[model samples]
Target: MIRILFTMIAIGALTSAQAQTIESGSHSTTGYIKSDGTIENSSHSTVGYIKNDGTIENRSHSTIGYIKSNGTIENSSHSTVGYVKSDGTVENSSHSTIGYIKNDGTVENSSHSTIGYARGVKKEWAAVVYFFFKF
Candidate 1:
Protein backbone atom coordinates (compact mmCIF):
# COMPACT_ATOMS: atom_id res chain seq x y z
CA MET A 1 0.00 0.00 0.00
CA ILE A 2 2.86 2.39 0.80
CA ARG A 3 4.45 1.70 -2.58
CA ILE A 4 1.15 2.27 -4.34
CA LEU A 5 0.70 5.56 -2.54
CA PHE A 6 4.17 6.71 -3.52
CA THR A 7 3.54 5.82 -7.13
CA MET A 8 0.31 7.72 -7.10
CA ILE A 9 2.05 10.79 -5.67
CA ALA A 10 4.68 10.69 -8.36
CA ILE A 11 2.06 10.36 -11.04
CA GLY A 12 0.16 13.21 -9.57
CA ALA A 13 3.25 15.41 -9.61
CA LEU A 14 3.91 14.68 -13.24
CA THR A 15 0.32 15.24 -14.23
CA SER A 16 0.23 18.52 -12.38
CA ALA A 17 3.03 20.01 -14.42
CA GLN A 18 2.16 23.22 -16.23
CA ALA A 19 3.24 24.47 -19.62
CA GLN A 20 3.94 28.07 -20.49
CA THR A 21 3.35 29.28 -24.01
CA ILE A 22 6.17 30.58 -26.13
CA GLU A 23 5.40 33.19 -28.72
CA SER A 24 6.96 35.14 -31.53
CA GLY A 25 7.48 38.85 -31.11
CA SER A 26 4.16 39.32 -32.81
CA HIS A 27 2.58 37.15 -30.09
CA SER A 28 1.73 34.17 -32.26
CA THR A 29 2.01 30.86 -30.47
CA THR A 30 5.27 29.12 -31.29
CA GLY A 31 5.85 26.52 -28.63
CA TYR A 32 5.75 25.75 -24.90
CA ILE A 33 7.95 25.25 -21.85
CA LYS A 34 6.45 22.71 -19.53
CA SER A 35 7.01 22.75 -15.79
CA ASP A 36 8.11 19.15 -15.87
CA GLY A 37 10.83 20.20 -18.34
CA THR A 38 9.28 19.16 -21.62
CA ILE A 39 9.61 21.64 -24.46
CA GLU A 40 6.92 21.30 -27.02
CA ASN A 41 6.00 22.96 -30.27
CA SER A 42 2.72 24.76 -30.73
CA SER A 43 1.39 21.58 -32.30
CA HIS A 44 2.22 19.77 -29.01
CA SER A 45 5.16 17.81 -30.32
CA THR A 46 7.98 17.24 -27.88
CA VAL A 47 11.05 19.09 -29.09
CA GLY A 48 13.38 18.97 -26.12
CA TYR A 49 13.69 18.86 -22.32
CA ILE A 50 15.41 20.62 -19.46
CA LYS A 51 16.24 18.30 -16.62
CA ASN A 52 16.31 19.10 -12.94
CA ASP A 53 20.09 19.16 -12.73
CA GLY A 54 20.28 21.47 -15.75
CA THR A 55 21.00 18.75 -18.28
CA ILE A 56 19.34 19.47 -21.60
CA GLU A 57 18.11 16.60 -23.71
CA ASN A 58 16.76 16.41 -27.23
CA ARG A 59 13.54 14.68 -28.12
CA SER A 60 15.46 11.44 -28.44
CA HIS A 61 16.71 11.93 -24.86
CA SER A 62 20.31 12.52 -25.90
CA THR A 63 22.34 14.89 -23.80
CA ILE A 64 22.71 18.18 -25.61
CA GLY A 65 23.75 20.79 -23.08
CA TYR A 66 23.35 22.13 -19.56
CA ILE A 67 22.38 25.27 -17.68
CA LYS A 68 24.33 25.48 -14.45
CA SER A 69 23.04 26.85 -11.18
CA ASN A 70 25.24 29.92 -11.56
CA GLY A 71 23.69 30.59 -14.97
CA THR A 72 26.60 29.11 -16.94
CA ILE A 73 25.56 27.36 -20.11
CA GLU A 74 27.49 24.35 -21.38
CA ASN A 75 27.58 22.12 -24.42
CA SER A 76 27.37 18.36 -24.47
CA SER A 77 31.14 18.08 -24.02
CA HIS A 78 30.71 20.31 -20.95
CA SER A 79 32.41 23.28 -22.55
CA THR A 80 31.19 26.68 -21.53
CA VAL A 81 28.93 27.95 -24.26
CA GLY A 82 27.34 31.05 -22.81
CA TYR A 83 25.67 32.59 -19.78
CA VAL A 84 22.39 34.09 -18.60
CA LYS A 85 22.86 36.89 -16.14
CA SER A 86 20.53 37.60 -13.24
CA ASP A 87 19.42 40.82 -14.89
CA GLY A 88 18.39 38.86 -18.00
CA THR A 89 21.49 39.70 -19.99
CA VAL A 90 22.73 36.88 -22.18
CA GLU A 91 26.37 36.57 -23.14
CA ASN A 92 28.45 34.33 -25.34
CA SER A 93 31.44 32.34 -24.15
CA SER A 94 33.65 35.30 -24.93
CA HIS A 95 31.38 37.43 -22.72
CA SER A 96 29.92 39.32 -25.62
CA THR A 97 26.40 40.48 -25.00
CA ILE A 98 24.31 38.44 -27.39
CA GLY A 99 20.77 38.95 -26.23
CA TYR A 100 18.35 39.71 -23.44
CA ILE A 101 15.33 38.06 -21.81
CA LYS A 102 13.34 40.81 -20.29
CA ASN A 103 11.27 40.53 -17.12
CA ASP A 104 8.15 40.88 -19.22
CA GLY A 105 9.10 37.82 -21.29
CA THR A 106 10.35 39.80 -24.26
CA VAL A 107 13.37 38.32 -25.98
CA GLU A 108 15.74 40.66 -27.80
CA ASN A 109 18.89 40.31 -29.86
CA SER A 110 22.17 42.11 -29.34
CA SER A 111 20.82 45.06 -31.27
CA HIS A 112 17.75 45.06 -29.02
CA SER A 113 15.40 43.90 -31.76
CA THR A 114 12.52 41.86 -30.41
CA ILE A 115 12.75 38.24 -31.43
CA GLY A 116 10.28 36.37 -29.27
CA TYR A 117 8.69 35.88 -25.86
CA ALA A 118 8.43 33.10 -23.26
CA ARG A 119 6.22 34.49 -20.60
CA GLY A 120 6.01 32.58 -17.29
CA VAL A 121 9.04 30.54 -18.27
CA LYS A 122 12.31 30.61 -16.41
CA LYS A 123 14.73 33.13 -17.91
CA GLU A 124 17.58 30.64 -18.10
CA TRP A 125 15.44 28.12 -19.89
CA ALA A 126 14.16 30.79 -22.23
CA ALA A 127 17.71 31.85 -23.02
CA VAL A 128 18.81 28.33 -23.82
CA VAL A 129 15.80 27.55 -25.97
CA TYR A 130 15.64 30.89 -27.73
CA PHE A 131 19.28 31.88 -28.18
CA PHE A 132 21.48 28.81 -27.67
CA PHE A 133 19.35 26.31 -29.51
CA LYS A 134 16.68 26.39 -32.22
CA PHE A 135 14.13 24.22 -30.41
Candidate 2:
Protein backbone atom coordinates (compact mmCIF):
# COMPACT_ATOMS: atom_id res chain seq x y z
CA MET A 1 0.00 0.00 0.00
CA ILE A 2 2.84 2.41 0.86
CA ARG A 3 4.47 1.71 -2.47
CA ILE A 4 1.26 2.41 -4.31
CA LEU A 5 0.84 5.74 -2.52
CA PHE A 6 4.40 6.77 -3.34
CA THR A 7 3.85 5.88 -6.94
CA MET A 8 0.74 8.01 -7.11
CA ILE A 9 2.54 10.99 -5.61
CA ALA A 10 5.43 10.66 -8.01
CA ILE A 11 3.09 10.36 -10.94
CA GLY A 12 1.23 13.50 -9.93
CA ALA A 13 4.46 15.48 -9.58
CA LEU A 14 5.73 14.24 -12.88
CA THR A 15 2.52 15.14 -14.65
CA SER A 16 2.64 18.67 -13.26
CA ALA A 17 6.25 19.13 -14.28
CA GLN A 18 5.47 17.91 -17.75
CA ALA A 19 2.64 20.39 -17.99
CA GLN A 20 4.99 23.22 -17.03
CA THR A 21 7.43 22.27 -19.75
CA ILE A 22 4.63 22.58 -22.26
CA GLU A 23 3.93 26.07 -21.01
CA SER A 24 7.57 27.24 -21.16
CA GLY A 25 7.51 26.97 -24.95
CA SER A 26 5.39 29.53 -26.76
CA HIS A 27 3.09 30.21 -23.82
CA SER A 28 -0.02 32.33 -24.38
CA THR A 29 -2.65 33.36 -21.86
CA THR A 30 -5.96 35.17 -22.34
CA GLY A 31 -6.10 35.68 -18.58
CA TYR A 32 -3.50 35.89 -15.86
CA ILE A 33 -0.86 33.52 -14.55
CA LYS A 34 0.84 33.60 -11.23
CA SER A 35 4.58 33.09 -10.98
CA ASP A 36 3.77 29.56 -9.83
CA GLY A 37 1.58 28.76 -12.86
CA THR A 38 -1.61 29.30 -10.87
CA ILE A 39 -4.35 31.42 -12.43
CA GLU A 40 -5.26 34.60 -10.59
CA ASN A 41 -7.52 37.64 -11.05
CA SER A 42 -9.73 36.25 -13.71
CA SER A 43 -11.67 39.54 -13.96
CA HIS A 44 -11.47 42.46 -11.58
CA SER A 45 -9.51 45.60 -10.83
CA THR A 46 -6.46 44.13 -12.49
CA VAL A 47 -8.18 42.84 -15.58
CA GLY A 48 -5.29 42.33 -17.95
CA TYR A 49 -4.21 40.17 -20.89
CA ILE A 50 -0.74 38.82 -21.43
CA LYS A 51 0.97 36.73 -24.08
CA ASN A 52 3.65 34.10 -23.98
CA ASP A 53 7.32 35.06 -23.50
CA GLY A 54 6.23 37.33 -20.64
CA THR A 55 4.83 40.19 -22.72
CA ILE A 56 1.75 42.19 -21.84
CA GLU A 57 -0.42 43.17 -24.81
CA ASN A 58 -3.53 44.83 -23.40
CA ARG A 59 -4.11 46.11 -19.86
CA SER A 60 -7.01 48.07 -18.41
CA HIS A 61 -7.32 50.04 -15.19
CA SER A 62 -9.80 52.43 -13.61
CA THR A 63 -7.50 55.31 -14.48
CA ILE A 64 -4.46 54.18 -16.44
CA GLY A 65 -3.18 51.66 -18.99
CA TYR A 66 0.14 50.04 -19.67
CA ILE A 67 1.24 48.56 -23.01
CA LYS A 68 4.78 47.18 -22.74
CA SER A 69 5.91 47.10 -26.34
CA ASN A 70 7.11 49.35 -29.15
CA GLY A 71 4.84 48.40 -32.01
CA THR A 72 1.82 49.44 -34.00
CA ILE A 73 -1.20 50.48 -31.92
CA GLU A 74 -4.43 50.47 -33.86
CA ASN A 75 -6.26 52.55 -31.25
CA SER A 76 -5.89 54.18 -27.88
CA SER A 77 -8.12 55.32 -25.00
CA HIS A 78 -8.37 58.85 -26.45
CA SER A 79 -9.22 57.64 -29.92
CA THR A 80 -5.61 57.61 -31.08
CA VAL A 81 -2.78 55.20 -31.86
CA GLY A 82 0.85 55.01 -30.85
CA TYR A 83 4.10 53.08 -30.66
CA VAL A 84 6.79 52.47 -28.04
CA LYS A 85 10.48 53.11 -27.34
CA SER A 86 13.16 51.37 -25.31
CA ASP A 87 13.04 54.14 -22.69
CA GLY A 88 9.44 53.36 -21.75
CA THR A 89 8.10 56.42 -23.60
CA VAL A 90 4.89 56.53 -25.62
CA GLU A 91 4.16 58.82 -28.59
CA ASN A 92 0.54 59.53 -29.43
CA SER A 93 -1.64 62.09 -31.20
CA SER A 94 -2.81 63.50 -27.89
CA HIS A 95 0.53 64.09 -26.22
CA SER A 96 1.87 65.03 -29.68
CA THR A 97 5.53 65.63 -28.80
CA ILE A 98 6.40 64.25 -25.39
CA GLY A 99 5.03 60.78 -25.84
CA TYR A 100 4.03 59.05 -22.64
CA ILE A 101 5.80 56.15 -21.03
CA LYS A 102 4.41 52.72 -21.61
CA ASN A 103 3.92 50.30 -18.76
CA ASP A 104 6.81 48.37 -20.17
CA GLY A 105 10.24 49.90 -20.74
CA THR A 106 10.03 51.02 -24.40
CA VAL A 107 9.69 54.27 -26.35
CA GLU A 108 6.25 54.82 -27.84
CA ASN A 109 4.26 57.16 -30.18
CA SER A 110 6.83 57.41 -32.94
CA SER A 111 4.59 56.18 -35.67
CA HIS A 112 2.18 58.97 -36.74
CA SER A 113 3.82 61.88 -34.95
CA THR A 114 6.78 64.18 -35.32
CA ILE A 115 10.39 63.00 -35.34
CA GLY A 116 12.17 65.72 -33.47
CA TYR A 117 13.20 66.58 -29.92
CA ALA A 118 14.12 70.20 -29.27
CA ARG A 119 14.95 72.46 -26.30
CA GLY A 120 12.44 75.01 -25.08
CA VAL A 121 13.07 78.53 -23.87
CA LYS A 122 13.09 77.20 -20.27
CA LYS A 123 16.22 75.22 -21.17
CA GLU A 124 14.30 71.95 -21.09
CA TRP A 125 14.35 69.29 -23.77
CA ALA A 126 10.92 69.08 -25.45
CA ALA A 127 9.58 66.97 -28.28
CA VAL A 128 8.70 68.80 -31.47
CA VAL A 129 5.60 67.25 -33.03
CA TYR A 130 5.70 67.64 -36.80
CA PHE A 131 5.88 65.11 -39.62
CA PHE A 132 4.38 64.66 -43.05
CA PHE A 133 3.93 61.26 -44.56
CA LYS A 134 3.78 62.98 -47.99
CA PHE A 135 0.64 61.10 -48.82
Point to the candidate with the largest TM-score.
Answer: 1
Query: Highest lDDT: which candidate?
Result: 1
User: What would the per-residue lDDT of candidate 1 be over residues 28-96, giving only the tens digit for each residue?
Assistant: 999999898899999999999999999999999999999999999999999999999999999999999
Q: Give the TM-score of candidate 2.
A: 0.26
Give the 10-residue window scoring lowest on summed lDDT in candidate 2. Answer: 121-130
Candidate RMSDs in order: 4.1, 15.8
| 1-135 per-residue lDDT for model 2 (tens digits) | 999999999998876543111011123222233332222232422333323322233333132222333343332242334443344354554544445332321212345332222211000001111111000
Model 1, residue pairs in steric clash: none
* TM match of model 1 to true structure: 0.87
Q: Which parts of model 2 are misplaced by more than 4 Å?
A: 1-46, 53-70, 76-80, 93-95, 98-135
Q: Indicate the worst ten consecutive residues by lDDT in candidate 1.
A: 12-21
Candidates in order, TM-scores: namely 0.87, 0.26
